[model samples]
Target: MSIPTGTVTFLFTDIEGSTRMWERRREAMQEALKRHDTILRLTIESHRGYVFKTVGDAFCAAFTTATDALESAVEIQRKIDKTDWGEAPIRIRMGMHTGTAEERDGDYFGRAVNRVARLQSAGHGGQVLVSSSTQELLADNLPEHIVLKDLGSRRLKDLDRPEHIYQAQIGGKEEQFPQLKTLDIRPNNLPVQVTSFIGREKEIDEIHRLLNAARLLTINCPGGIGKTRISLHATTELLDIFHDGVWFIDLVPVSGKDGMWQAVAGALSIRSETGIPLDNTVIDRLKNKELLLILDNCEQLVLEAAETAGALLAGCPDIKILATSREALSIPGETVYQIQPLSVPSAAEETQGEKSCAAGISEYESVRLFIDRALQIRQTFVVTNENAPALAQICRWLDGIPLAIELAASRVKMFSLKELYERLGDRFEALNRGLRTAPPRQQTLRALIDWSYDLLDEEERELFMKLSVFTGGWALKAAEVICGSTAPLPVTAPPAWRDFIDPDHNYTYKTEGSIATYNDIKPDLDVIGLLERLVDKSLVIANQTDGSTRFVMLETVRQYGEQKLNDSGKSRETLKRHLHYFLLFVENYMTQVEDVTQNIWDTPIREEYPNIQTALKISLTEKEYYEYGVRIISSLFTYWQYHGSEMEARVWLEQFYPFPDYIQDPLTRTWITLMFGWILSSTLD
Candidate 1:
């Protein structure tokens, strides 16, 4: 039979208490499951339903018509109730939803499939739940014995919008059951999110899994990584698990420990007693309640939050705490989960893979997130092979971070994709702004990074800027060798770091930090110990591959630090040191091969390719290092030839051509003339 293609009805079923039954009575449950499957399969098939998937006594079927789906669900429940199982009786919970869903390889997916699954979970055993769409379909044509009891608007778990549910009563008798398991049964203060939740399915699943094993699970990542949104979404999915409720407490305004306790109390509506303090009242109110507390933006008040979370958890055994911070709370029984950025397609995939076509490029999580937000701005915008590389480049340039991607996507309303990609070289101006309604720190990319940067001490800020001189990434040895210079820096921070409200009462931020207003302080730059600490603080990322770790910054972060270096009037000396290090790196001296050697390593050349390019650009363009720049280009000749960078090399060298007449150095002139001729010949060939 040809599979149902579009505008189909999905019927999802599960055996209530199936897991407990399997554990307690494996053999009996197995036999009961076989009988249950036979009843459902026969009834569904008899009603012209296509069973797409079955898992552990559950069935997900699709029907061409909503009437057929409704009839199948009602028939399956009746058949299961009357079946003769000696000891174990099987009760089936069913859900029916009708919407437009496209079939893929004999399976179905879309919001319809998801809605039906959520509907099925909201029903009790021996009952069938129907969505409003399905109910509207069967409005006049419900069989004589079947009637739908209208269950007015109820919010289903994991669904953003509320659903109008209906209970299908079969056999002409109204069976009494408990209330429909919906979100209204549990109270929550979870904020109503406006935009659609984008990628992070795996992260959300991992968060839930970790929460099941431990009470306190903290999602630690750099700022603007979407921790607050992901934590709220995860809590919404878990509404049915906790009886009391879930509460999202934003700690952005909280500065002290009392403010932290008061925030929780205010969220929970806990009133202070005569002698009991607000903190104690919070504990007393939550002592017996089984609830989830989401503490967001705790990095500012991390110590106070840690103390408050510790006290609350110790007071109540049933309460679980999920926190979002730049660093861990470091309390006992805390499961720290570092949420990484979304998956982005490599530059090679963007151009080389057949999958980079318009429809296929969205397979990358970061690209999908971008496309989702971009659609809101310009619905007609689409990705093609020609523009797919630019789209992939945008996501990669922003390091696959969600907030940065969203901000970049917002520019589709103003600029073309190519203009957006070209403007990303100045990361601050291109991706700095976000939705004005968002929190202060999140309103702009600059504000977000400033929150993390301002938290660093004098020494960390110095090393952070020094480390930015290396492109792509840097190893610990490179950071130690170059950043440990005993120079007392001019400033420890960017011009400004603001997380304040303006006169108009808008909760916005200002992070335009080319304004270099800092006190004169001498912070002895410490590299080795401080780099590790910065990694722990989420200001820096330590990527481990091939059994060796490389410390790196997000390109946005590097840009921020680079902006500071340029503003502080330190780029000449700092960039000179960077050029010298790579000069040795171009030779084999900087690597483990040791000794002053002329032979260059291809692997390091490729890994540090961006740094080499930056060095060449800076040295040749800057007046002080024209000779050294020419020397480095000569050194990279073999590396560039093998790398097929002939066109790129030609472009870089052409900028330095028609040599500066002030140069009287004969050897420099000789090497320059030969290099230009060689590149010109290579290009012609």
Candidate 2:
């Protein structure tokens, strides 16, 4: 008989636990194997099916129709159930799938064949499992004695997607053997996490609730913020609720919207036949089933992911989607859960006297994560009074970001806790090493920030690169003054403006009558809109303080932006603008320091301390700005005295003031001498 091509139904059969039976009774097992082969082949042939391949006690066959395949599977099971072997009983498990395959050399090969074999493996002895495609084809054509029982969706080995499995129940003795082996099984495709999932108890519960409340929930967070891990933990916890099976579709490998549905189809094991449209096949197969789909890393394909999710939610009422991206999908019925960084201990908590070894460290999620991960690299590692503060500082410096913490912790094998704390000053270089299995972006602190940075538009990228000048965070006015450029920008500019204009080119600027040169045009930079966009993208975070909004970049993100600034050779120019702006700010605030309310005066200065220190350091490096640094330092005397930061003030004063260049103006010199004497006296006593 010739092999069938095009759309065909495959029936794969195997003896359940045949190896044990063969070991128990070799002679009887041989007879049983012979009978099993004979019954399966004869039934398949009688039902207009051809037995293509057989190995030992298993048989792989193909039929032209699902009716014939189901009939053949049932007939084979009935014969095995009733056959009287001399000393042993034989039971066979069968599975069938209807899909198009190529006919070559009297054998077939394709996803359909692989799927049918997996379906067969998902069943128990005396049971027949069929793919939803084959079951749908059977429709009203199944024999009266054979009924299809829905076994629900299952993830088979080597298949990217979950398959909706059904079992064929034959009447009489074959009707009752044991429950289908795959019945209690839940489809879990999540990668096995090597390390324990620490912290996020509240987040896990909240995400679970959101998923239940909303059909489409997207976990929005910046890279390395643990969105994927959180979503997996939540999905794993809620697996039993999704009767059809929980499926994980990684969209990182998928490019655009064109491939989104195909990725989903692949994850669901829904292969299209010769003439059928894949999207239509996916919708048809999933419309009635209840399942959860986890779409990971959708930031690169946000629009496509959103569109596909919208389509799926619209058509499939019972299907729920949980996606992870740096931004939201923005579709109707979508719940955007912004994942925050792990909790870090406050300065007060860090300074609190140490109680004991590993004491109170678990209270902060970030600290707990760091400790746990550090122990992975150094098995003897433990948090004690001596190292607890350093650990807290490490977590805080990492902004409690899970990936950052893990990368930092991985270095415990090579560095001491105090050394790690000290090295965080160069965070990008310190936290560069990451697990090899992680995505390229997640391989290092710099790479993760670079991934997010590369996704920005031209204007956003420009703003991000310049905003690195600020140390802690910046007010809108400060950012606008420092980052905004009044000079003309090229229409088609390179990554950095410095890269576009070459000194050798000698391209003289000419504002001619008819055509203006590239250097004569200025692009309007919308600082507000760009900052808001950065906030939306999770690159910048905004905080409302004292009736005004303050924008801040996490330390890791700031380091990344600063690196970009230095690479573009804009560090000095940007830092000049920053120093000039803050110098003017300090001079203006000096007169009001006495009359200003304690809360009001202290808050702004304390917040701006990091930027001020950054500016002062930048100024001391250059002769032209040395006076600006001394003047700014002298102006903050009242701030330091009032805020009880005299020791810190003394340290900065000693570091910069004791330099060679003497004070120029008598009044300024007198004020600096007096303040310096007072701080010195306080410190010496």
Which candidate's lDDT is highest?
Answer: 1
Tens digits of per-residue lDDT for model 1, 1-685: 5678778889999988787788788899888888888888888898888899896788999888888998888777777777887768778888999898755446655567767887887888998889999989899888888889988998775576989999998866899877777767678988766566666877887898899999999999987788888898788777778888998899888779889988999899887788878887788778999999999988887899899999999999899999998888899999999988888888777556676765567678899788767876776666666787788888888889999999999999988889998998876787666888777877889898888888888888888888888888987766765676644333222112233443544332223234222122223455768988788778799989999998888887888888877887887788876766665455332223322222344456667878888878777756666665665665555445545677876887787766655345665566567667777887995
Could you tell me every candidate's TM-score relative to the true structure? Answer: 0.77, 0.65
**Runs off by more than 4 Å, candidate 1:** 1-65, 72-128, 157-161, 169-181, 376-389, 413-433, 486-523, 588-602, 640-657, 660-669, 675-683
Q: In model 2, which range of ten residues has the least summed lDDT? A: 491-500
Candidate 2 lDDT, 1-685, residue by residue in tens: 6677889999898888787788799999887777777777788898999988886788999988889888788777667778887777887788889998755447665567767876786677878888999888888687887778776776554355778887787763335545344324566556655555676977987998798799999898877899988887677666668888888898878997769989999888888878887777888899999999999988887889888998898889999999998888888998899899998877777556752224666568898778767765776666667787888888888889999999999999999998999998888888777878788878998888888888898888889989988887898877777786554222111011011122434211111122112222233578888888898788888889679899988877887888888898878888887887777666555544443225434456777878888889888878777766777776665556655678987987887667535555555555556667778887886
Off by over 4 Å in 2: 1-184, 273-277, 355-357, 487-523, 592-603, 641-649, 659-670, 677-684
Q: What is the lDDT of candidate 2?
A: 0.76
Q: Give residue 574's error in model 2 in angstroms.
A: 1.0
- lDDT against the true structure, each candidate: 0.77, 0.76
Candidate 1 positional error at 343, Å: 1.5
Clashing pairs in 1: none
Per-residue lDDT value at 450 in model 2: 83
lDDT over C-alpha atoms for residue 94 of model 1: 88
- Distance from true position, residue 481, model 2, in Å? 1.7
